[model samples]
Target: MRRQTARLYLAALSKYCGSRLGKLLGVGCGNGEFLAEASLKGFDVSGLDVSADAVQTTNTLLGREVARCSTIERAGLPDHHFDVCVCGYVIEHTREPLEFLSEVHHVLKPDGVLLLVTAASGSRPVTLENALLRTGFRSVEMMTSASRVLVLARARVRRPRPLVSVIVPVHNEHRTVARLLETLTAKELTGADKEIIVVESNSNDGSRVDVLRFAGTPGVQIVLQDRPLGKGSAVRQGLRHARGDIILIQDADLEYEIDDYDSVIEPVRTFQCAVVLGSRHSGNGKIRVFADQWLLGLVFNSGHVILTGLFNLLYRQALKDPWTMYKVFRSDCLHNLKFECNRFNFDVELLAKLIRKGHTPLEVPVNYRSRSFKEGKKIRVISDPWTWVWACLKYRVVSPYGGDCTRRTENEMGDVPDTP
Candidate 1:
């Protein structure tokens, strides 16, 4: 319980403090550090500060397209526009911390959060100040890290608390799994809202040993695969055992860069979106993404976007690329879905199922680094536009969520292995 609680509180601080409903007036928006971050994450932001210099700095930093002056908070900037009001290091220096907190509440959409991170006073603060913050808001909680506080009181944040499940699909990654287990063992996710579920598949590589080591960690559980299967299969099995309101899908390969659990859960913690796909196509991705394959790789990527785009649109779903990158989804969303292809093709099928069910998904661009062929590029000659397209079309016609899908009697397609 404590493990899950720790995660929930931490997620609340990192991602849930949007101007409540993403409608808000930010005071002391200096240089717009939080504002720019929010906007990049898809929030609608309007900001203000006592210093014009600060406002100029923000515009200078983020470019005019994304930065705007907030001296006009008087314009009311769309009333009830924020889900969480941001108070950076402002409270400690301000004469009226409480009134400023009140302003945060005012511009905040009712039920929005107030996120305050300031230097602790006099006697070196313990995590307990978060408790005192609830006095001014609705509820105050400290996340996994001791430096931040999530305050929600005046109005209730829609998801008073979110349940999150971290799913790691493991194969022969024993060395990496040890690090992952170490990380999961320390996560502060709790209160029936969090769990770290690792699904192990055929690992001639001893990866299962790493996962088994966490057999006793609170909220840490593992399910073993009966046979060697693809990464997607392990993900499906992990999801079946997941016990959280939100679910995350991550590769155990250790190539995807993620530093904090909060950064991992931020996408689904605050919004009603059905799924969030991590993109390597956004932001400073160039710094991390190297065009590893010099051949038809570029064409392969372009074709992937085109084919998946068509499949998604044909199913009425809008997405950039369904077959690549890490993905996160609501547990309920997957409950209504089905995976037609078990191997690489299943990635395409997931998007199809989502679209067929009328879900509009979102994206988050995170750091991505491609690996070398020596690092196991399981995708081979057959896993290209041909296979992706063939499987994509095959599922659209016969998969459970697709338009023409008629549940086949068990005797039909069961003979085919679920590899995608």
Candidate 2:
């Protein structure tokens, strides 16, 4: 009967987990039958039982110290360390079943699988499934074999492919807005789900008509403003309607390449960081300058260097291009924070507030093609610099969290609100 039960557990594991070659743990492993069998089947197996004799018998049978004599709660196991855990006929005997299941959930990896076995007459399947759900398990499946019930569940802590919200603040880019929208809405662009929010700020260059062409398209949201506000206003409006887990800012013009999206979003997607900036001058040796506007380019590039240096000094950061248009971040990073910039200075304000709030952005090298003034460059060369400087100075002193400028501790900083 023990051998037959071990075979049933292994079969269930294989069916649900696909591959059985990762780290596996057996809870209440009696006599080491399941542990020994799983080890032979290519799993790096370990076991824990409350009885010292059971642990000793298992270690002796396996010719090694593979079993520990302790309950799951007191075992002091590392979190997210196991790929698969088998609890064979153990849930019925646990004094605090919810706590036992939570400990198993804690130790299992994000994509880990849990197989629980109990007596058929112990509890109803629905009751067991609800308990598993409360303990952070999903896709709960129950199977009955003779007088035993087998429950299979997956950890809910796994990171699902996130929905990316691309906010395109359009001005007078009639020449590229339509093509940009088409490319953005393409299915082959990315594997993750995307929603394109086009905020057209009442363009007179027929850009409004171009944007209207994409209206009512699936997963495409169009917001038309009464008049031209600024990139910052458009972004704030888009945020009100954004429902994605990740938020990205995209320029309507073709200056920034769309091909760099994957590299820019990879770090945030993998949970390595919450904020990322697609820099135009990081890996590239020299900033790209248009041949026709050499003098204008020189002035702009010089301004960028000075402003970047000033920003780094003010914020105690080492960023290359803080004013880059390709900013990507998780939407929840904006929780309890308010934005008030309405012009080119918005970039400075946003970056300053984010850094102040403890989300230092990760910069990734990206391709950039500068457009000349004849192609509708928007920033005012003389006045915008002063506004940016003021923004840099103001945000450093003012509070983005409703006049609460107190710096958060490392533990307190992790409490971001849910994304809308």
Lowest summed lDDT over 10 consecutive residues: which window, candidate 2?
411-420
Residue pairs with clashing backbones, model 2:
none
Name the top lDDT candidate. 2
Specify the highest-TM-score model's number. 2
In order, what is each prediction's RMSD in angstroms? 19.5, 15.7
Stretches of model 2 off by over 4 angstroms after superposition: 1-160, 187-191, 282-285, 404-420
| Cα lDDT, model 2, residue 154 | 82
Clashes of 1: 36
Local accuracy of candidate 2 as per-residue lDDT tens digits, 120-168: 7767665576577557776565555445567778886633557899999
Task: Score candidate 1 by TM-score against the native.
Answer: 0.52
Candidate 1, 289-406: lDDT as tens digits: 3366555455555565677577766666655546654777656555435564566666777766665444566766566566545565556755555767886676666645443332
